[model samples]
Target: MSPVAVILTALPVEYDAVRPYLTAPEEITLSDGTRLERGPLEGTPWTVALAELGEGALTTAILAKQIINELAPEALLFVGVAGGLKDDLQLGDVVVATKVYAVQGGKLTPEGHQERPESWHGSHRLVQAARSALRELRPDVRGHRKPIACGDVVLTDPDSDFAARLKRSYNDAHAIEMEGSGVAHAAHLSRQLDALVIRGISDFADPGKSAADSSGSQELAAGQAAKVAIAVLRKHQPAPEETPGPIYTGDHIDFSGGTFHGPVIGKQSRP
Candidate 1:
């Protein structure tokens, strides 16, 4: 049977933002002890397979591969909050990644570290859907389509040496987050799985993270990201199963609901 999509989240806050769209939810337990919340999306033809996969690219890749093997969702969308890397992206804005850069790849040489970035492009179909959905969404919600850097390190200082290294190789990135590269890699390996990474800006990638959190930027950003995702979902209509074809990937999101008020919702799967 064909399922709608696989929605993966890194943190509980991110997971919570998208949970409300799933109705008639079911809980499934994997052999590895990871639990999944499976259900049909309200007013949509998709059965969303949702999970909070924790953090980091390694774990996310492993778990995403496992989920794809089990559910085989038509698309895999990673929703979460990220630190703003570009000046135009302010706290609470949304960013849909055109590509995810695995910035941690490289080797430390005798003189300095050399960058060897691993990148994965967002599925073209899926991304187009997001762009279409963007047109239908309210104009005031700031959103941008740009590249995002994915690394294991949490950057708190834009003036740090590590930040300098990132700027040298991936200066065009609009935001920074963890686990996007891992999920994109898993989708690449799957060949048929369409993957996208969507993030809400929560901080400036500087030292004032705690202050931002205290000011509820994370929550607001999360909700904004979720809102944009839902818009994509509303506009996206899954293509019918075609004759087995070549590599075609991108994000396509469609949303269905009433007014455009922003709020976050999600489910928790437990043993």
Candidate 2:
């Protein structure tokens, strides 16, 4: 069987950006009625399965596992838009997450809220493929391989407590999003699968986010992210499937008196 890769998105815009890159898409309805599209990724040797898993880490995690189990893909990628956290990242810039931080796990103490952070790194092979893909991207669309912080809240205030917590604890994260950590965790649990998260900076996680969305930044960001994701797929080559040795089902002959020239293989032998 050809190698398969699953691409998941959290929003319709993100899904739309990636849908165009698929050819001969056929819809697949899960047992729970969730729909997905599976097709060959244009210009690549991979069969891509795409789904729009609505917002939230928990929901994405559950659905991602279901999809993984159903499709048994070689790799999985979450492609979408995120709020930029770094000063240098601009709208439409793509970020390939080297790791995903689950920022919501913590403890509330008498002194203050204490953090019990959990994180999962992206597949090293996928990260290297993404690095190579970036070179083929447009010069204006900058790509970064950095950490991403994932949480449940839609962070729109730079001065908010959550934002401060992120700044203090996840200082290395370049982007904030809702689902990367969940997907990464699920992928990690699937020992045989590889996973990555690719996001485009749609806003700065500040008061200006609304304005940026109104100006169509989300669409642009989603498109840029989708491009990089497909490019990564092109650069990545899945491992070849092992060929099974020949099977002999006939009644085996006794080799006690015969001088065999080569090794004999059989399932059963009769004297």
C-alpha lDDT score of every prediction, in listed order? 0.86, 0.92
User: Please, what are the lDDT tens digits per residue for candidate 2 over residues 4-53?
Assistant: 99999999999999999999899999887779999998777899999999
**Candidate 1 Cα deviation (angstroms), residue 113:** 1.4
- lDDT for model 1, on a 0 to 1 scale? 0.86
Q: Per-residue lDDT for 1-271 in model 1, tens only?
A: 6456989999999888888778877889877878989888777777888899999999999999999887777889999999998877788888999999999878899989998888999988889988887767758568888999999999999999889987888998999999999999999999877889999999999999889989999889988888888777666667665443334333344475443533334433332
Q: Which portions of model 2 miss their true places by more than 4 Å?
A: 246-271
TM-score of 1: 0.86
Weakest 10 consecutive residues of candidate 2 by summed lDDT:
262-271
Error of 2 at 67 (Å): 0.4
